[model samples]
Target: MSQTKLTPPGPKGNFLLGNLQEFQSNPLKFLLNLRKEYGDFVQFRLGPFQKFYFINDPELIKEVLVTKQKSFIKSEDIQTLKTVVGEGLLTSEKEFHRRQRKLIQPSFKRSNILSYGEDMINTTLNYIFKWKNGEERLISEDMLNITLGIISKTMFNMEFKEGADVIGEPMEAVMKLGIKRMRKIVKLPLWVPTKQNRKLKKAIHALDDVLNEIIKKRRACNEKHEDLLGVLMDAKDETDDTHMSDKQLKDELMTIFLAGHETTANALTWTLYLLATHPEVDTKLFDELNNVVGSSLPKPEHFSRLLYTQNIVWEALRLYPPAYVIGREVDEDVVIGDYSLKKGDTVMISQYVMHRDETYFKDPTKFVPERFENDFMKTLPTYAFFPFGGGPRVCIGNHFALMEIVLVLACIVQQYQVTLPDDHHDVKPQPLITLRPKHGISLLIKDR
Candidate 1:
């Protein structure tokens, strides 16, 4: 191991803003350029106060996230998320994160997945019934509605019809404000009663009231159900003999909703967009669906038979991972590879960039589900396609999300062929709390 300190080269930007302006303008494109210009390990500044190192090399990425993970916590960037989600799983650190992850892991096990599958199928079918042949639909919005319904039911064991009316619009408003606050260079104080701040407060209150009422009723009922909330309610961390408090439960519920609902919806939206743009992909997917399910709703038992459908979902994730960037804050002075990472420094890895590297994937930008024929992905290094992240904090719902996507895609594609609307919408990824379509994708829903 080398003992000397060696900094990676990076572009010089404005004296005051450093690289903040470029990153704020277009984070994905900015990061891509940094990789192209600065090689594997690139050092840059966010502002006079913040410094960062970008790790593009897969080997070193493993070192930061897995081999020596204890040396880092989630980047300070996520602290902004605390405003919306509170100190839930995504924002917590160290032993707390570990303990919470353990308590929550049971709900996502393969056994429990079978239970969630029914909810997924029912929710998707309900939403799909609204589409008529040759009708142009806002696919992004529809996906968000469908995912929000599924997650709410699976997590709380309740229908969205009851809470969605009160929670839907406000929750969406808060999310928009939350993303803006999370990325602002000069973030405004929450106490300042500006119009946007007031709007955020209203949004937060609207969601909080609905969630609090639900928690209250659940507590009073004192009965167990097969929902994630029920599991969380009864789970006592034996190490401390303590159960989740009401506040903690709400926080975790919010975190789960954001992680489970929004990310999955964006993934589905991207998958639909990809299928619409590539007619050959559409043909192959329908052929697979026709052979396997044959005009019937996709069931849990049909899981393994829908191999090609699963590949299509994986390809969509590889190209447009909802959380494009995963960031970690250095907790102590540590050596990774040949470089010394000082305490308080931030290191980031872009799943989006690594997934599209020409070195790892042939025709990296194209959507080629066939590339995954016969479990071909196993040949690649782990970091090359880590859409759900890695190590101890990897997304707990990854398996559940994948299952839901494959089943939903198989169900929808088995009956419909989606075509793009003629409005000429400039569809692109908007890097926010999740990578969403900047302008909603419009698609014509037609019988296959």
Candidate 2:
């Protein structure tokens, strides 16, 4: 085993659980404060089983996630997600992940995603019909429904009215259970006969049923379409193999469905909420959008045209990053900066903290979209603003998510003005799978 100093310049951790308690309470805030107190490197123990070296240094983070990626593996916490996502790209082994990523890559081509633009526009308009004039809509739920619909329509050509709530109910249950487990309020495994375990099983079954039915219908059809499922059905591997098995297809489809909607929906929701509260930003964005797309729906061609609007999206992602934290484990003893971590030691790159690092960003707390206009943004260090993560395992549906967010934002802005019902309510972020508003942001939507 390699040995190096374990010393870090920070408050010593608690003897029992180290800093796990504070971490569990409000992880995003805790890490932000911890980084403030500890500087770039902090060491803590996760229970008595493992040690974690939280590295806030950008260079060191790049080394682990990019340059020295082969020396590390997805952390144990990520491994726990295998039950939910299966051995899909997100939680699979290095070789398996590589193979799956290669296989699934063609499904997310720009052309394929562009073909789904009409579906996205139609879905957004469908949701707009549900909004009552001057009704207080929980923007969180509204955004969830919108993204869920978009994912269903674009990915599988399913109708939002017919499909979203059905798939969403189980997903919500699974997410609630998952968050509870992550918080350690419940400690039962999947095989256990407890209530949470049972609910997890049921949720899994419900989602499986929905995906299986969709898959079956697609398979039975004679002709092919340009949606995500069609691309997956046509994807070819290295050995000239074509087609994913029913089981593989189901797992990947469900993974994309949940991940596709949940993360992007939370991001768009936060973006709108932020814009609603900040009138100057809102008006600036409105002017930009009006100039770019006029009174029409957004298209792939308009993405580059709305440069300022895109910057606002980037800034919002930095402030309330959907993929809050990414973790990895040292496969062998290694030195990161001045700290040494043993094999099996886990490390977290908290984007919540990293994005807010005052050293990297001026006035880190402010939402200034213009910062992205700097030439250095294209050359910014890795993990500095990795809302979608970094390196090989970066989110595959990134372009799709971006396209959806821009289109959805454009659609909503064209029809309604959003404002928080109560201006003084605390708008804290709660980090689960994605960083979401702790309490739902209730907004009154006035027709434009």
Candidate 3:
């Protein structure tokens, strides 16, 4: 006789909406509270039919993302994202994703990424140099703009400073609308003329127009450029000898455009906020920068020697991960740990929740950059500190993002002292498609 496995205990809600209202009101708090009350593997409902399992245990998360990853696929939110990004690497699946990854892998090679360091530093310097000493600015927007400029110049061999508004405004609208679509139980077709639907379409169109123009110009150019766009355009499959179509190029470019800058921007914003609030950490960081680079611009060779600088970024990521949650849906009936999950069931793993778990770090709620010193990462489970995610599907731009964050921070902090305004209030993390600062981070800047 076979033994029976009962569903894990979870918060019981009314028969109809079952946990949907609670989740939508505040997702981060709901998940944190759920873990505190229901333990590691808790099963809950979203709508009338959708089943969700929240996994806080590191081993179970590993199973879902790595060991038995084939049994699951991206969750519904990612499927929702395809409306904006098309079938790019972030939303693609199976063999197609593997193929695209292979074709695009070389552009992120160690040597290739090192070459982009100069552009990253120069872009940071140029943007920050314009800031008048003792001026107050929304550091969040500055981080976003500088990162957008860096990604554009390094990847596409083009400057985005003049067109920043063209991309920035519409991109914000798209991300806001994307989150709304993900949470709604009844999604209307894009063809429908509802106000939200029309707005989404308009935002997406604005983005499409900008990207399509770039793709068109790149295709028309005859020079064999060495940048990421050039590499993508010229790459040929080993077996088929076929290059990416314009549509495919646009999809990948859109994916990179959003992922390359937005997440890193948030990371840096949080980092600056953390540094502003914690003066001791900020002082140590400045000390490291002064000793390592010594009144010169940050270069690729200086990256490895800046251990404290890297730890500060790592700590920021641990606290406020840009992609706070990773969701997956079961592709087929599978068993994770002792739980029996049926096909169509969704699994949620939150880096925000996990990074703060007391089991992994001492004084989990506090900001302590020194926690990452002395090989602290090696002691934790792989999934416990997964800011870039894990498995074959881990972020392809992890290396690029890390290098950019460290270099940009080095450049700016060495030149300016970033401190919160005297009237600065606490900054709250806004849980969207990517985690961002609510309202925005306002800071006082002065020449160091």
Candidate 4:
């Protein structure tokens, strides 16, 4: 057997703080540099106590996420998210997680996903029509607001067309607070009365107030609705009468929004940015859309026919995966590659790193939708391009999101021509909870 006890080679940081300061400086650059210097697998310490291992190799990533997945749970980092979204699928552990997943899984099935198609396209086009030609729009905020509305309409039966800020603002505030709190060196207690803490508390209260009202109204209603909430509320297991309580339903709603909202928005934002920068690729996508989905408007039935549009989404996901890293913690002694990991160790597998590695993708940095045209996915390892992660723990919203993204892109492209700023330098990748544009992306559009 390989010496699983051997520690992977890595740089030593300060004895007291370990790598905490270096990590706090610029997480993306630091991690990328570490990979360049130490090769695929590298070990580092967060402080005197906490140890972390970064796995960049795809086959090794599959081993942890798929074959030996039972030995791990979500990383300790997501505990912060649990405070907001509660013990829904995103943070639940062991058998409870599995059970909740089974219950929530049906809402995103093919039939249900197809049912959502009308809402997805109608909502996107309704929002897009508000844009004026020659208007310079902040692409990031627009995408965030629109995707927030999409999730709300699709899941909760809410319409915030004119004022998505009702849901958008508080959620954005709370999410930013969560990300900020996650990076604290010595976290301030909630009762400390700091301005930041006070703001965070306010944000949480505001979000809770909205969620509480939605739950109350839904419970009071007798009429059935064709939305995710309706399915969740009516869901039952024949083996047992167990179903989500109102509070549990609220938790899962928050989890769905938290998981689905900004990530999909960021993804849409990046895809537009990429298309804007690459005119040739943009023309190809528009041509494909014109041929397959022109004037007639896009629906779920068109998903199969829009092959090139779907490929563009795949390539964009490969380039700028919204969830940059998938993190998990060891729950027991586990062997991964040549290293033995004890309980309490954190493991991170980066989609950003692997997707850009020259070893796997030729001309990895270039935008190439053609790469996805072939049976490349079959030839690649399961984890080589895992934007939604892998294994039993993979993101449940994968199919829904893919279909929604393709529909939105196809609908928008069929009628409008997107023009990007000549200088792409300002819109840098900001790795927060999602990979966002640091300065909001500036864009212009005209009806084609």
Candidate 1 lDDT: 0.86
lDDT per residue, candidate 3, 178-275, as tens digits? 77887776788888899998989998898888878878987887888877888888888898988988888888988888787889999999999999
Error of 1 at 238 (Å): 3.0
Over 4 Å off, model 4: 162-166, 188-195, 423-425
TM-score of 1: 0.95
Top-scoring candidate (lDDT): 3
Ranking by lDDT: 3, 1, 4, 2
Model 3 segments beyond 4 Å from truth? Answer: 1-4, 163-173
Clashing pairs in 2: none
Which residue runs of candidate 1 sit more than 4 Å off their true CA positions? 188-195
Candidate 2 local lDDT, 246-353, one digit each (tens)? 888887877787678878888988899888888898888888878888887766677667777788889999999998898998998777876777798888888889
Tens digits of per-residue lDDT, candidate 4, 1-448, equal 6766578988799897788888877777778888899987999998898899999998789888999999999997786677667798899988888888888888888777888888888888888888887777888887877778789888887786533656777787888887788777677777799988898888888998888887788889899988898899988765688888887888888899899988898899899989988889889988888788776888778987888888889899998899998889999989998889999999988888888888889999898999987788888877888999988888889988888888888877887778886654566788877787888798888788
- For model 1, what is the alpha-carbon lDDT of residue 210? 82
Write down the TM-score for model 4: 0.95
Candidate 2 structure lDDT: 0.80
Candidates' lDDT values, in order?
A: 0.86, 0.80, 0.89, 0.85
| Per-residue lDDT of candidate 1, residues 1-448 (tens digit) | 6775677788877788789989988999999999999988888999886789999988999999899999998887697788788878999889878988888888788787877888888888887977899988889988888888888788877686744665566677788888777766666778898888888888888888888988899999967777888888988887889988899898898888888888999999999999999999999888888888876778877777888888998899999999899999999988987788899999989999998999889999999998888777888888888999999989989989998888788778887899887775778999987788998888999987
